[model samples]
Target: MRLSARLLLVCLPLFSLPGLAAPVADLYQVREPVASQQPEERDAALGRALETLIQRLTGKADAAQSPALAQLRKEPQQVVSKYGYEGDALLVEFDSISTERALRQADFALWGANRPAILAWWLNDGSEGSSLVGDGQSAAQVLRQAAQYRGLPLRLPLADLSEQLLATPENLLAGEPDALRSASERYAADAQLAVLARESDGQWQAEWRLWLGDEREQGKAQGANQAALADALLLAVSQRLAPRFVVTPGAATSLTLEIQGVDLKRYAELQRLLEPFAAQLSKVQGETLTFQVNASVEQLRAQLALAQLHEVTEQAPATESDAEAATDGEPGPRILPRTDVLRFRW
Candidate 1:
């Protein structure tokens, strides 16, 4: 039988009964040109900065005339905004900006940041789109939503969990029932998504698959020759995970994202699942996105305590006022930690 190798990353957080809800927050990393401003002017500066940023990123020769910009140019009555520093970049959030202009500005800004080849883009109102939109479940869905927010159309290449599972080594791979039941709970994935991808060598392909029940008969075993195994497995994966339509970009590129806000101990399995893609990844920033072991003094103290080491000096005290204080005069919602952490200095 031919040997076929496939690397899969499964992202599913642990779940509890109806009482506990899985935490949801936007996790992001954007390249820097950090914004600093006074309290009152901060909103306008950030908004203009984002608008200028969109123009820069999209490579639009005329910023004002662009359709996307036209939408954002007309300011909203209630422009909710927030901002903070994450490593090397400023993380900002804008809510209820009236039209799609704010999104347009941000999208173009990300486009300008990444440039001509967009990694991915999607916009979903949860129900109107695939499971990848609102309350997006799978890794692919999350990636798609991120891309959409940036106005890029980079799609994932794998979708069918069963096909992905079966393609791996016998010991590493699980079957339908266990794979679906276990992976669903583990990865926070719904039953549907679409994926498009480009190989490391610059070949574009698409695939998609839905979650089918495990009770059905296991597909017949195949013992293919060495050369055929790769082709066979690729076909299967593509059939199950391909997008409804595929678009070929002039350039080959992919986006690297780092998430925070996750409990490192609780997500070890997901981290392991993501390891394979990490290895195959050619274009990446920094090292693996590990937990922020020492973001604050308290975190450092916690680590020291866990190591059972004696404190060298008395720890500095932090106050409830400081904890509750808004980052940059914005609301507290902007302070949410990144869920999937990356070490990007950008």
Candidate 2:
């Protein structure tokens, strides 16, 4: 099936979690060139390819050095669901469970497939001239390739008449939020990355800013070429956006989810959604459903954040008397300070 069609089908049953999306393409597959088709050479290449996959998933350059990951390297075939060759490249499909097991063992934060798309606005200043990097441009190609390697989704600005009037090389380089916001409003991207590159004294210096929701991070890098600059810029972007964390074994905690406005059908849907995360629905009284999950509160929240089914809002804690009075069919007081309280939208 087509990827888009497959994604749509998966989205229906899975709801908002990106992890349940289609697994085709290089999402979990890694390809490497082998010197020969010999079994030993292919085995060695698989090991190297697995390391590359681990690095891409964790957004850490040295993820393969972890003690837990050492086992996967020793037995690279353990994760291989299938393998084949296209010309000089050996294509390997990794079993999802095997890959997840290694990541879980290594305590790596898994970023689900439902990732935020970034709209990139690029401006380049070279000895030849200054120009805006448009779609399919050479400069844009560098960014696209870098994003693809890291599994990041990116879109370039249209630079239409309206965008041209608002956003220019000067404003983009100055990091004007207003100009950038105005030009980016049409794309409706989950995030915006503004990059300005200039060459001076034969060295390329680039400045980049990433805006995701309300968070913003910006940095500068100097490299000998555009490739080097692109690499550095993407590394910074991955570190900021990738959902990764250091897993602490045996540190899981339980949280009660007080979902408001849940009907029987919605509750059932909610149950199905939470079940994949190993969450047990312990109690369902009215609209509030309590779950016993074997994960840290932050991890649970992160997973939920990837879903589009709910919107998390902070509420003040109820007083002791208020909590007691909340029973008997009356709506309960909001749980304050704890982010465990979630409200499902739709």
Candidate 3:
């Protein structure tokens, strides 16, 4: 079944959640050039920032052409929570709910903050010598800007005594897993990128390896400068990390879920929690809620996996007294079948 126009109402009541409850990073904000303080200039800057936000959200460079993007640009302030100047640049923070609405309307895939953080280990091979790129280094600046634009959270190795004892330029270039793991353990990054770069005949050449969970990908890029190489590497890395979604109209499905520990306050919190799913909460009877979502079962399941919400497991059958004890608030055993039934623990 297709999602109806009423799905637009899903954005309502989501902003009531306290600011302290927000994710660690504001993914919707972007920094753009501010040519002047004129109204038209500010509006143009807002439009550019919104475009960057859309690309970051959808993980597609052409997301500016999404149908709902025009409406978003027309009323940029609606999606804009605030804007201010940081030096000559204008930093614009977009309302997360409004941004999600535009993405849903455009039928784009969404990635939430629960994504894996990447620990980047980079070495620059220059005339002087091969050295690791640590925090506050020039190479780190380019990597950070590229990662931020693509909405990928990345960190460089500290290159302190511990890192020095564990990793070396030779080991990093050779893609030594033991050395990388030893150095990266303190950061606890879900993925790792190892890069060796050199400037050759006025061009930059980079050989890179990416490890995502247990999977690995390797490639090389040649660019005119460091910034160009950063862009190339980030594009490839972001594509691997971000989930992709296609617009499949008239393909929605409904699901019924039973959740424990959901009293009145928790009920409100649950609504706020599920806001990012963009599913319509069709009905709520006590602890169970029925939802009409715009994606297939597998898609919904994958999205939920990224959210890192309560764990879901196959429910075993409960005895008669088990049900009675649960009703009596004694925390009796419960089970959700592997199929349609979902039991969320608050």
Best by TM-score: 2
- The collision pairs in model 3 are 315-335, 315-336
Q: What are the TM-scores, per candidate, against the unseen true structure? A: 0.25, 0.69, 0.64
Q: CA lDDT of each candidate?
A: 0.31, 0.66, 0.67
Residue 44, candidate 3: alpha-carbon lDDT: 91
Please, what are the lDDT tens digits per residue for candidate 2 over residues 1-346? 1223233334545443332212213667776778899999899889877876776677677778898778778998888899999899898888878797878777876554445667888777899986667775667787776666566777888655666555555666564466788667666666788888899998899888887655678888778888778767776787676643223556655556655555444554555445535666665555555566666665555445433345556567677767667665566665556554444444
* Tens digit per residue, CA lDDT, model 1, 1-346: 1111111123233431211111122312222234454444544545554553343333343444566555455552234355666654455554423223454444432121111111111111122223222223344444443333333333332335443443322212233334334434433332222222212222322232323221121221111321222233222432232221111222212323332222323234323323312323232122233332212232222222221223333234555555676545744433433333332211
**Candidate 3 segments whose C-alpha is farther than 4 A from its true place:** 1-24, 34-44, 71-78, 136-139, 161-176, 221-224, 244-337, 341-346
Candidate 3's displacement at residue 41, Å, is 5.2
RMSD of each: 23.0, 7.3, 9.9
Tens-place lDDT per residue, model 3, 274-342, is 554565666655555556544555545433433233545754778897979989989776654655545
Clashes of 3: 2
Count steric clashes of candidate 1: 32
Clashes of each: 32, 2, 2
- Model 1, residue 212: what's the lDDT? 25
lDDT of 1: 0.31
Candidates 1 and 2 compared: the better one by TM-score is 2
